[model samples]
Target: ECISSVSLSSLIAEEFDDFPDAELILKPISDGGDGFLDVCRFHFSGKILNYQISTPYDNSELICPVLYNIDSKTIYIESADLLGLKVVSAEFRNPLKLSSKGLGELLLKIENDVSSGKININKIIVGIGGTATIDMGIGACSALGLKLFDVNDKEILAIPENFNKVEDIEWDNKTFPFRIDLIIDVDNPLLGRTGAATVFGQQKGASESDIVILENGFNNIRNFLQNKDITDSSNPTFGAGGGIPSLLYLLLNAKIRRAKDFILNDLGIGRLKGKVDFVITGEGAFDHQSLMGKGAGIILQEFEKRSSKIFLLCGIIRNEVNKKLPDNIFPIEINSFFQNKDESILNIESGIRLACIKIKNNL
Candidate 1:
């Protein structure tokens, strides 16, 4: 069996081609990150509202996706459009300078559109992940009318490097007319060793020194919030989207939900229980991280609850072969078919087809 999530439509098509006679159900999945809007476009019949927003790196404009459903009075926004790493150039991928201000700007724009009768929105669903900043969402809060000041009572810019200089935060009393739901990809807390900055800072082009700065920045915010008795710094999923969820939870009273749960519930996956014989799911790479409540892992767990067989086919498997997995669960590591990573990746289509064929024959 073979399956993929997010950016693997071509791969899924190829798999279908190989098993033309087999009954296959194709469901494109996302953990509220990249490719979220693409999946939402398929499920929701809505108008695609486009807005030019500033990219994470500089003043470059990016056309962001906001789905407006008139029937449900809901709006869906993918955070990656404004905060994804891909929006920043490789040479300019510095988290310290990046700000999530664009996200706030987009939200305000949505409100304006709604107020003008251009769009009807009562609830805003934001998919938050694959971000390029570690500013603890201070940048976004700044745009949302939160004032950050330095010890000298001067306003401080909402950037990662300036987080440590924040002496107080003042709210502008601005409120959105719609309720907000933030779909978080990970369950990591906002601060600590396994937190956002420590785990994801490097991927955003942060050096060791820069990581420490981000960590300290996050700590400062946590301390400030805790002192006010507004929120607990140890909240899980607080670290998602570079601590975007934490601030949103505090400022907007947004509800944070697991991306997998949100997707499954929205799609009505419970109806498929027992009707489906097997479930196949995979990602670009499978490791301990996949088990960390990601889309694929959650899919597996969901199917397991239904007592269905599960097969995971992935480009690479980082876990040891001897590692224990569920009894009915089988993992097909496509990299094992080739001598090296390059060769395996180069021939991914062939590998997936072969893996599916092998699994079919074995069963």
Candidate 2:
């Protein structure tokens, strides 16, 4: 349904309203992706501050929400709001042309706000997922004073298309005013068969030919950095968000934490009272990837031992992954209840309601 976890949890609770005898423990979690800011707002007392920033394509501006917690002196940012795949139109989903200038703009805004005494914060938590660009964070670094030059000493734009032309690089001398923490779910490395360009390029509108170019583009940057005596970023999590987090880690010393650990630290599994009768969780597509440190996987891991039964209601469920699930875990593909794909999407609410009814009948 493309809705927030808070909204989905509320909807599920309403569907099971007739079962008043049972207690509903709604714990909405985020694996540092689309609903990161919403999860923060749900768990913490904060005010949503809107800031105008450039979009991924940089052809327009977007107003993105930043969760500011004055008491905690922390700010939360969801990368999806700035450069997510969902934000870019299908026709304009070319990673070669996209720029993460908006993410840089947002960071600069926070820096300026802190320096001017407009806001006091000690930490910035960024959810680096769902990005559309794979420019090795060059677009973002450019906004922070990075400069790229060609062999002829001509300036080069910070985009994948120009990566091959880049011969020299310059970094921003300014240091960030606060600590930066990046939360990521995937474990792929920055460059390789399992890396960003190869694994995620197609989803970002990259063709087979485009993926080859993108891989070379990433290699150009790595070679440049290696020549400068910089340690290569081979960390698995560095691959998340089109290698954006990897660049941020090298350039800004941002700390990277797995989404599962981050969520567990914030909401421990032990906090839930009594034995849980049923655990209901969902995502857009439940597949092998979902088990790879995604929110749904974390939910399943934590509640499997505590709950009597777990309901995995997803829009589309891959049978291969479903077959590997535990006996007590029930996977319901919402589309099975509808006539067609379009009908399923249109009646998503009803599909979920019907799924809940089936669960109720079993109880």
lDDT of 2 by residue, 1-363 (tens): 456788888888998889877788778888898888888888886888889998888568889899999999999999998889878888889988898878888999999999999899999999888889887777888889888899999888888888877899887565798999999999999889999999999988999988888888888888887887666578887779988986788887889988987787864644663467887889989989999999899888888877788899888889899889998898888889988778888888888889989888766
List the lowest-lDDT window of 10 residues for candidate 1.
Answer: 1-10
Give me the overall lDDT of model 1: 0.79
Off by over 4 Å in 1: 1-21, 227-229, 305-308
RMSD (CA, Å), each prediction: 2.7, 1.7
Once model 2 is optimally superposed onto the true structure by TM-score, how far is the C-alpha of residue 362 displaced, in angstroms?
3.1
Total clashing residue pairs per candidate? 0, 0
Q: Which candidate comes out best when scored by lDDT?
A: 2
Candidate 1 residue pairs in clash (backbone atoms < 3 Å): none
**Can you write out model 1's per-residue Cα lDDT over 1-363, one digit (the tens) per residue?**
123353455565566566545566667777888877777776786889899887776778888878888999999888887798767778878889999989888988998988999888789988888888887777888888888789999988788888888888787656899999999878888888989889998888999999899998888877777777767667888989988988888877888888777868885665577778777777768777787777777787678767557878787767663176777877888888989878888887788777777667644
TM of each candidate vs. truth: 0.91, 0.95
lDDT for 305 in candidate 2 is: 73
Give model 1's TM-score versus the native structure. 0.91
